[model samples]
Structure formats: structure tokens, C-alpha cells
Target: MVTSVLAGFAASAVLIVAIGAQNAFVLRQGLRREHVLAVVAICAVSDLVLILAGIGGLGAVVSARPGAVTAIRWIGAAFLVSYAIMAARRAARPSTLNPAERTPTTLGATLITCLALTYLNPHVYLDTVLLLGSIAQQHPHRWLFGIGAAAASLVWFAALGAGAHKLGPLLARPAAWRVLDGVIALVMLGVAVNLATG
Candidate 1:
């Protein structure tokens, strides 16, 4: 039982620790200190729901629908591309990239963007729902595995969102923010292209 839980945690950590859209967004929000708790909560909760759904047999259902996945891919690619363009614009304008100088986004808008970034990424479904879910079934205690996976998600997001502020001193300058935004834009565009082409 303990082994199953550990297995789940390790599997989830491997998938969640990547430099993905979700992670990037979380890091950015954490650095800005905007809705950090809310963002982390939403991400962790969403992962829990999706992981459970997968373990509950939703993965099989989703896997059987190739068309749906394709639709999600295209939609996700479009959203990501749009986001990349916005990031690029921010990077180009170093003044606007500075968190201290920029206007704070509303809670509603932040939440909306968070949700869109989380849900619009087809990789989230593939990794959390399908991949993790399928792996959980291999364990003798599948539910335990789900719990472990959920725990990993919660821990990772919490750490990422909470720990990001430590870099506040480093990102204090507009040049640093511009570089960060540039990296973000590139990451977004890379993911978008992968989704569109893959």
C-alpha cells in the first residue's frame, strides 16, 4: 500500500515538474504576487478532480474519442498562440513588463486566465487524466495511488506559487522582467506549435 502511494507520487512528480504552460503561468503569478493562493488552489483542485476522474475510468472514455482530443488540441493551440503574442508584446515593452509599474489584473480576470490556461491545454488532460489514471490502475491500491498523485499535485503547486516570491529581488528590474516575459513567450509559442503540428 505504501509502495503504491510512493509509486503514484513519483509518477506524478515526473509529469508535473516539467516546464509547461501551467507551470509557467503559476510561476509568473507567484512572482507577481497576484492571487497566488487562489491560483494554486485552483490548479491543485483541478488536478485532483482530473486525476480521480482518470482513475474512475474517465481516461478510457476520453481515449476512445480521438475527435474530441483533436478539437481540444486546435483550441488549445489557438489560445496558446494568442497568449504568446501577448507575452511577446509585454517583452517588447520593458516598461509594461515591470510588475511594479504595471496595473494589477483583476481577480476575476486572473482566475479566468488561470482556468483557461489549465483547461485549454490538452497536455493536462493527457498527462493528468489519461497517463496518470492509466498508471494508477496498475497498482493494487488504485485509490491510494490517486491520493498520492493528488497529494503530489497539491505540494508542487503550493511550493511553486509560494516559493516564487523569493525571486522578487532578482526580478526587480524591468530588464529582468523583459527577459522573463521573452522566455515565457517562447515557451508558449513552442507549446502552441507542438500542439498544432502534433
Candidate 2:
């Protein structure tokens, strides 16, 4: 059972680690040092809610409605492609930030942005609630799996946000941002292509 729970958590983390808008936003905010804790907490909580909902039978309902998932897949693919373009554009003109501006401190604004990024992204529900939840349900003590998955989200968000802060100097460089954004664009484009093809 413990092994199953750990496997569920690992699987959940792998899925969530994709280069989507939310992860991009989190990394960017972390680099900017803007409301890291708030953003992390919001992401963690959102995942918790969605994972629980999925484990509690929402995944089954979603699976029953193939149309909804299909629609979301297309929409998400479009969003990812758009985001990729934006990142590629940014790569061309990376902006260097002042050290003073890179302090993650905005509370309300960060919370709102994190909320919008997490909730508005339909892919979050499809992946976290539907895919992860459904897979977890197959294990005994499904609740344990849910807990482990939720813990993964919390750990990931916190680590990504806080850890990026330590790399402020490197991230502040135009060259570094360009490289990062370029990588982001490629990852997102790959995901989009996979979505369209799959």
C-alpha cells in the first residue's frame, strides 16, 4: 500500500512537471522573486482539491464524458502553442531585472495570479483530477494515494519557487532568460504537437 501511494505520488508529479502555463508562471515568478510562498501555496492547494475531487469519483464522470476531455485537450493544446510563441518572442528580447524588483513579496496579486493560472487551465483538471485521480483509485487505500499525490504538489511547488530564488543572478541575465524561455517554448511546443497528434 505504501509503495502504491509512493508510485501514485511520483506519477502525479511527473504529469504535473510538464511545461505548461502554470509551471511557466511559477518559474517566472520565482525568478522575479514575487510572492513565492503565496504562489506555491495556491498551486499546492489547487492540486490538492483537484486530486481529491478526481479520487472521489470525478475522474469517472469525466472519463464517461469523452467530449469534454477532447475539447479541453484541443483548447489546452492551443493555449500551449500560444504560450510557446510568447516565450519564443521573449527569448528575442530578454529583460534584465534589478535586484530590488526580484523580491517575491506581492501577496494579493500573487494569489490572484496563481489562482487564475491554476483554475483557469482546464488541463489541470484533466490531468490532476481525471488522469492522476483515476489511476490512484485503482490502488487500495486510495485516500493514501491521494494524500501522497497532494504532498507531491506541495513539495514541488515549494521547491521550484524557493529554489529558483537562489539562482537570481543567473536568472536575471538576458542570456539565461533567453535560454530558459527557449527551452520552455520547445517543451510546450512538443506537448502541443503531441496533443494534436494524439
User: Which segments of model 1 are wrong by more than 4 Å?
Assistant: none
Clashing pairs in 1: none
Residue pairs that clash (backbone atoms under 3 angstroms), model 2: 33-103, 33-104, 34-104, 35-104, 35-105
Roughly what TM-score does model 1 have, to 2 decimal places? 0.97
The clash number for model 2 is 5
TM-score of each model, paired residue for residue: 0.97, 0.78
Looking at model 1, which ten-residue stretch has the lowest summed lDDT?
93-102
The model with the greatest lDDT is 1
| RMSD score of candidate 1 (Å) | 1.1
Tally clashing residue pairs in candidate 1.
0
- lDDT score, residue 27, model 1? 97
lDDT by residue (9-74, candidate 1, tens digit) is 999999999998889999999999999999999999999999999999999998999999999999
Compared with the true structure, all predictions reach lDDT values of 0.92, 0.79
For residue 125, model 1's alpha carbon misses the true position, in angstroms, by 1.1
